[model samples]
Target chain A: MNAYPSKLVERAVEQLSTLPGIGRKTALRLALHLLSRPKLDTHTFAHALTEMRDGIIYCRQCHNISDTELCSICASPSRDTSTICVVQHVGDVLAIENTGQYRGVYHVLGGVISPIDGIGPEELLIDELIERVRSGTVKEVILALGTTMEGDTTNFFLYRRLQDFSIKVSVIARGIAIGDEIEYTDEVTLGRSILTRTDFDQSIRF
Target chain B: MNAYPSKLVERAVEQLSTLPGIGRKTALRLALHLLSRPKLDTHTFAHALTEMRDGIIYCRQCHNISDTELCSICASPSRDTSTICVVQHVGDVLAIENTGQYRGVYHVLGGVISPIDGIGPEELLIDELIERVRSGTVKEVILALGTTMEGDTTNFFLYRRLQDFSIKVSVIARGIAIGDEIEYTDEVTLGRSILTRTDFDQSIRF
Candidate 1:
């Protein structure tokens, strides 16, 4: 054990070290810094974590994080109810919303099915998503997931489950990112881009 | 404002981002991770910070962080009272104590005098240090501070103040670090090592 003069400080450092990327040395620095500040700073910090954890709720409609029964995006009248974007987490929903290009709402799957991690379809909100689709309101289900094996596995699983419905299912485009030099592009992505080329008539915009 | 799905999450991120080295993106990740865990985890983390901040105190003798009036080092009977090591923070005390080579007690100055940061000698525990020296128990005061400009300035100021006393004042030796290559050592450190080389008769120990 490092020579922490106070037991309180040792406990604080222990708890802080559990956070991602924070080691014992950095935990000590943060603990000492918090100790040096006014009491109100730590008070607010503590309250924020505690209150947010205790008071927060998951959205009933799409399973995104929410403070109410429905998230703001799901509750918005302008959002397209006909298309539901499928994602692995609430963060993905926020990322798509930030682009402002997708006017459709989203359905958070909580996580992808991974047999190694013991996560099955039952563990995710797949049933609720099926229930939503079975209501006969949605026209399209977009698979905006990573190209990793687990993501593809989940996408295929969802595609099979939603096969009974007469809805369109599409995966997000896989290509070299904008502004990426052609010489630096990976072989697999560049090959796929060439094999599945799309129309070049799309308007050029930032 | 980044699109945090919930106001509670946004508030948590805002508070978490205030810590050193934690930016908005890392803060969001942390907030989401905390939310994903059981409520007890965040409760413990929050309680640790609040309890430590509210209950911690500075030792009366050494001014190191303490839960009691006197720090453990100051209260220990086996420690030497004749020599006192002056440090800038509690972390430095831990660093010196880890070596297990020094048995002397420590005096934490809180910080060094840095005119650029508006930190004066009065803002530190210099007066308390002088009072400790005046008690006539200490015979030597070791300056175990960084080699920064502010550290040098503080050392000179302390030297001037202790000029009236009949005590030995010394600084920790500066040399190339262990495992460092001689060729890669900076010019200033190499020059100082050459100027102040010690006797080789001492046994080389791991």
Candidate 2:
């Protein structure tokens, strides 16, 4: 009268349900759809998933996804090393890169500081960034992180840490809404907006 | 400027996009979410996808998904062998299986006969089913395929073919709306609804 769906279907259902917005019914539907596919297609799909897990490594320099020791931006000699853009995540790095205007390198903080989530300065890559700045290779630090409360907290922490440094610290400007996801924005507007960003402290001249 | 997203991200994105409703944005969001997760969690997630794809195979007897040559229903000697339920896809099998009443085996036709899509009887596994029936191991065939135009067309074709056999032929109730997906219906309604199915004849069935 009762049995769990086969172990494979159960596993597949559980995994698919973990994705954002997918429910048990949707997961079952998706699993059934996938099962109908030819074995090779499913195998290839699985292989891709497995390879994705094994292949991507976080860049040692900026924390962006990379195949090698550094991400593309960190490896590129043509990029402006004097200007480093700090962002909340690798996705943010991609969002800024999609503009094709920012020739400077980047630093991904892994995530914003959120007390609610128990994330703080020690949990982020702020110490590595401070060391990078202190190494005398950077002139400007573009704070392109989100404008959320957590983003503000991370930004303030960096501001205090870099108080004695000679680098110019600026945040990306306000064409973006406070609660919006940056990845969905158009490249041109975001580029124009980033280019026109104001300094964090107006009293301190560069 | 034209470089693809890293191979790992691209692979995950491609696989995710192949799902029914996922798009590139959603795929990327999911990929980044998985990327940000701990290594073991990501590995387990990826492994589940791959294992489901590779380990699961169609049951030779019922065409339902299974890890073995025959599905659980087909292997169970306790189930009725005289009545074989025919469905358009495996998902229909799950929908029917959700109802505890049906104790018969199943036959999956892969898809309906869609003239517009150039799908015909030869394209489906109908011939194999005819052979299975002719072997005298079956007495009745209940058509659980949907009520779409293609489904009707396929049913008509199958009905004509099965007319030669002495076995009784019936259809699941037309209580389902034409073009309605069976997966959306609840178990109790679907179960009680199937008990009252009208006999099919092109002229008087509707």
Candidate 3:
């Protein structure tokens, strides 16, 4: 006779082992622990997972999770409509939002302009961003991009396009080290960067 | 701003941080990694967790995950219905299932008798197991309980009660360490325990 009796448990462990950094032993342990939970708890956990899959939808306007066409920030009347924070991805928007100090809306670039990875400005949402800038409602463009080669290239590309517009172009503060992530940074440091941001010189445009 | 922008990602991290051994930074990292995965993957992961929480119902006959009155093991035609392997918990049932060698059904005691934890025989499924024995279909009862003090007490109690029934009662091999779990024991050692099981000499029924 074997030590365990359920093939279901073994199958569940095999599935979990496929996840990043999880091994077979760890997966088995986790699966057993999961099976130990109350049936109601498991049901609620599964329901939440299903809801996360089915309920979450990208905001058409700002590419954030939203029920409607636009995100809550885009629909808000209190936010400054004249300014927008252009970020590398959807996660950056949350990092900024956590501060609760920004009054402007956001635009997700989908990704940065990486030449080596074959990611070009044409591949990103830069054209749509230019369209937003040309709409005349936005008077300021905040470059909330990350500190990477792609971030710098995207910033340069956007700067060249926005040179014709008489709006202000600014970058988030540079206390964040090269290759460091803003998401993991403490609130105080991230908040400090927001307060002491530098203006992008118009001469560097193009 | 961070590279990612999902607020739900941030909220999820915050919630995850509340779990044991999970800190805020680790939570954020795990959340971001999860967010990076395809929506379907996240849904599946959540579904697994939820299924662990709710979908599993203990079999009425053998106290394992089952859709009907009896567990798969108990309902199987090829299994030895006369011999039942007794375990401390449903998890132990799973541990035994992993070996794929056992041809008998299982009886889960829910937990061992623990005076410190205030758990007694009435709190477990011992009475129900005794009733199953009294029915006379069972010829042998294998005690696969843990080696803890509570487990020993529970095993002794079962041995005493089952002594009235006209059947042989055996205890699984004692090579398993006093504190070690049967679940974590190597498959080879576990197999040996099942093969070289000893008769419960304390029983008068033998």
State which candidate has the highest lDDT: 1
Instruction: List, residue by residue over B1-206, the lDDT tens digit for candidate 2.
Output: 23434777887788888988888777788888777667687777767866887787778877777878877888998999899999988777777888776999889899999979988889999998898899897999999888777888888899999998999999876556567678988676577568876555753843
Instruction: State the DockQ of every prediction.
Output: 0.74, 0.37, 0.19
Error of 3 at B77 (Å): 5.9
TM-score of chain B of 1: 0.95
TM-scores, in order shown?
0.93, 0.77, 0.60
Whichever of 1 and 2 has more DockQ, that candidate is 1
Instruction: Tell me the whole-model lDDT of each prediction, alpha carbons only.
Output: 0.91, 0.81, 0.73
Q: Which stretches of candidate 2 lie over 4 Å from their true place?
A: A1-5, A175-206, B1-5, B99-101, B115-118, B135-139, B175-206
Task: Report the number of the highest-DockQ candidate.
Answer: 1
Evaluated with TM-score, which candidate comes out highest? 1
What CA RMSD would candidate 1 show?
2.1
Give the per-residue lDDT of model 3 (tens digit) for A1-206.
23333445545565566555567766666665667756564455445444544556677766665545687788889989799899987667777887777999888888898888898888888888888888779899999898776788888889999898999999876666567799988786688677876566852662
Shares of reference contacts reproduced by the candidates, in order, are: 0.82, 0.49, 0.27
